[model samples]
Target: MAAAPRGASAADFETAATHAIILDHRSGRVLFRKNPDEPIPTASMSKIMTVYMLLEQLKAGTLTEDDTFVVSEKAWKKGGSKMFVEVGKQVRVGDLLRGIIVQSGNDASIVVAEGLAGSEEAFAERMNEKAQELGLDNTTLRNATGWPDPEHRMSVRDLARLASLTISNFPDYYGLYAEKKFTYHDIEQSNRNPVLYSFDGADGLKTGHTEEAGYGLVAAAERDGQRLIFVLAGMESARERATESVRFMQWAFRTFRNFKLFADGEEVETAEVWLGEKVRVPLVTAEPLALTLSPDMREQMRVEVVYDGPIPAPVKAGEPLAELVVTIPGVETVRQPLLAGSDVARLGPMGRIAAAVGHMIWSAE
Candidate 1:
């Protein structure tokens, strides 16, 4: 008989942000969530999409780092977090990218949008189209600069997803996020992402702020090969956003531990095999199974093998014959395949008959 594992109490961590999400980058797991799906003004975090679109162009060979784009009057005259790009001057694609990422420059974002799509409105339309294709259901783009608009909003979940994609898909360009400062037209500004300066494994991402959105950040960090991407919105101040983000990241890494529960070819259980020379077959996993859990939750973790009884006839080595289900409180259940560890040949005729007779006697008893 198979039994489900015991459940443990959920984590007690709390945060001040109204909307946030923490995701495991490698496994696509949601480590923590709070109103993640609710749409909110993303402020400058929406610039990530603008950057993503430009990276796509770079990858497609339509643009290059050395290529220069002419800054328009609209970009030079734009407000908030200026890259200070002068009108009628051609800036390298690489520098503009750094400006947007390191400086959170609205002007640089608008320049990229206009350079590619010919106008901010047209580029924003493309942004919406790309958002749909990326499965960002709660994301809508009104402009490249993330200027406040009732129509421009993204869910924290979507922001986290975008950050993940940007890091994973555009490794060559992702380094710009870690750059502390960028200089353009004799003006320099520091990267606004709080995690970059204080967090050990922190790298590039974006920060956003507006009267409407308050202060927000899309942040990523990696430690010991594990990466976490998180999004926070509706923070009351820059200090609050910085403090809460670091605390949340610390909790995620410190509280949970990833343990290797099963190694490849490690026998997990013995399953009955009918009409076979061997009465039972060893069941094992073909690959290692690693799970993340808190210490208390690990103590209560359950592992169950589910399969039909008396697997009939010959069983081949490495044949998938059972399921290994792991349950832990406050986390999604993990299912892994259990495979036959060795071959089990069918029983000879006499042996089969004797086994049948023994089975009948056992049934009668």
Candidate 2:
């Protein structure tokens, strides 16, 4: 998916951020992108991953909200944002999550890291391993928090991917990002995510800032039945981060609409079979198919099923046999595989001979 105006062939949307990407959550389509793959300093936005590690444990039943982790001297002494956790005091898993999400507490991040892996270094190792497993090719974790480290980098696209995973895979824990404030030891700090406060449907994600990374945000929102996730980095200030993020989300939701072309296993075309028990086999989509398109492009969309004619016999159900190509004016062409919808048994020896003769005769005619 791509963004374009009503009659333009190229994207017209622009942003002030150094790197960015907007994604349609349901269809997994990229609506807009600019330098999305470049690895750069992530700042505290990396706490989303730190919190994600904890969420995994909670969802898997390995850790409960009541479970406590003793805060270390290092956690208490760490600078930047603070949850005001006391040194040597055991903190609940739930409060630490709020600290990390709502307060952007570096101390809380470290507490979770140390409690889960015995040390920040070990926890970062697990983060790296999990990044690989999640197919985030441009991310590297050097510490538990998104502190200013030279090697602690993540691409805007990777951050969007991580945001998507966090929302879809851990819905129960993802709500923490929407929390407005969290108080610990009489100290209260508001969540750093700007969209949560400004946007209509906005909820989760995280924010980041450093002299090197500037300001960044991973914002998500849902309106009506659609959801979008976007990432931004290298803005000059918090105000710009907030303005651009909300504007981008509004632009994305306002412009593009996701259109469902076919449901899973829905037949799109029928292809002739060669010497099979059946004369033809239905071609169907293996997964639900949807695309994000501007309203203008939607009217001009064209679909085609391309395949070799008279496919060989003994076709098994779900075998890839064709391609469904969708073309929309002013947007990139999309192609997806089409599968055989049902089994088509090969004809017996005599039946094959007779069918071949019939095919030959039909060809002559």
Candidate 3:
């Protein structure tokens, strides 16, 4: 198995946000990150998980778009963003989903929670379970609405990971995130995700803000054939979050490009064989080496074949013998195993004796 780059340094970039990350969706590569693992209040970004849980049930055939849930008094009176759902009025699952996603309605989240799990508190427990199932270690969900609870927190990386999973796992329902405007009960509001309105190829995901969590966004975009997922949090204001998010996405797509570094079965180097019929064996990678890099750094990329010199005889074809170490100036070093390209038989007794004599002469010099 080959190791991937850790992440490139981002000292050259500027942003008002305190926590942020950018990832290559196809390759799962971390292009840039700042305090990505630090746990912080996610605000309504936690709603992504809530929406994801509902989507899972939808995919499982346990829930339907047409199914309706009555709005309880709790949902009707809940503050923050509103979908204006009337108490005791039954609302379809589909409309509530749109309400939560587009309108950021606290009421819609509570209704879905109670309808699905009998209560918001019980539904929050389900969110925590789903977080564990998704391998999100840094996330803790205390409510479905992301209601500014002290215990409701998630890392920026987890938010990006959730966004990636939502896009990949539930393609059908993912379109809800892209809806520009959704009206329920004659109340209208545009999607809060700034990227969707500002940039081309920007699709789904969510945004978050509160007195404790500041302003944040979990966004994804696709251009050409590549996709990128990004997360930002702890911004001073919504304007700062929107401005920095667009600039960062533009730089990610414009400044970096994917390049093929090595072709499969292409010999990268040769390793010496000791006391064998063949003096050397070709070293090659089994898979193509492709990487995303900035134009200026491509020239700085280096590949080195490292191994114990003069590999022993009786080496088998396709045996692991060495490693190809790849390094770039601002990126972490990646290593790929290099395999022996062919078998090599040991030298006969007379040939070995002659080789020993040559080795002694070389050592004496």
Backbone atom clashes (below 3 Å) for every candidate: 1, 0, 0
Query: 1 or 3: which has the higher TM-score?
Result: 1
Per-residue error (Å), model 3, residue 194: 1.5
lDDT for each residue of candidate 3 in 1-365, tens digit (9 for 90 to 100):
22334565557567678888888776667888888888899989889998998999899999899999999999999999889999999999999999999999999999999999999999999999999999999999899988888888899889988888898899999989999999887777999999998999999789999999999999999997678888989998888988989998998899777777788877989999999889898988877777777777778888788999899898998899999888988677877888888899999999999988998999999
True-vs-predicted CA distance for residue 30, candidate 3, Å: 2.7
TM-score per prediction, in order, is: 0.88, 0.89, 0.81
Put down candidate 1 lDDT per residue, 1-365, tens digits, no spaces.
Answer: 11122122223567888888877776666767788888899899999999999999998898999999999999999999888899999999999998898888899999999999999999999999999999999998999999999999999989988998998899988888899988877887888888998889999689999999999999998887667788888999999999999998888788665677887789999999999989999999878777655677789788899999899979999999999988876556788889999999999999999999999999999
Q: Order of candidates by TM-score, top first?
A: 2, 1, 3
Q: Which ten residues in a row have the lowest lDDT in candidate 3?
A: 1-10
* Model 1 lDDT on a 0 to 1 scale: 0.86
For candidate 3, what is the lDDT?
0.87
Clashing pairs in 1: 177-204
> What's the lDDT for residue 136 in model 3?
90
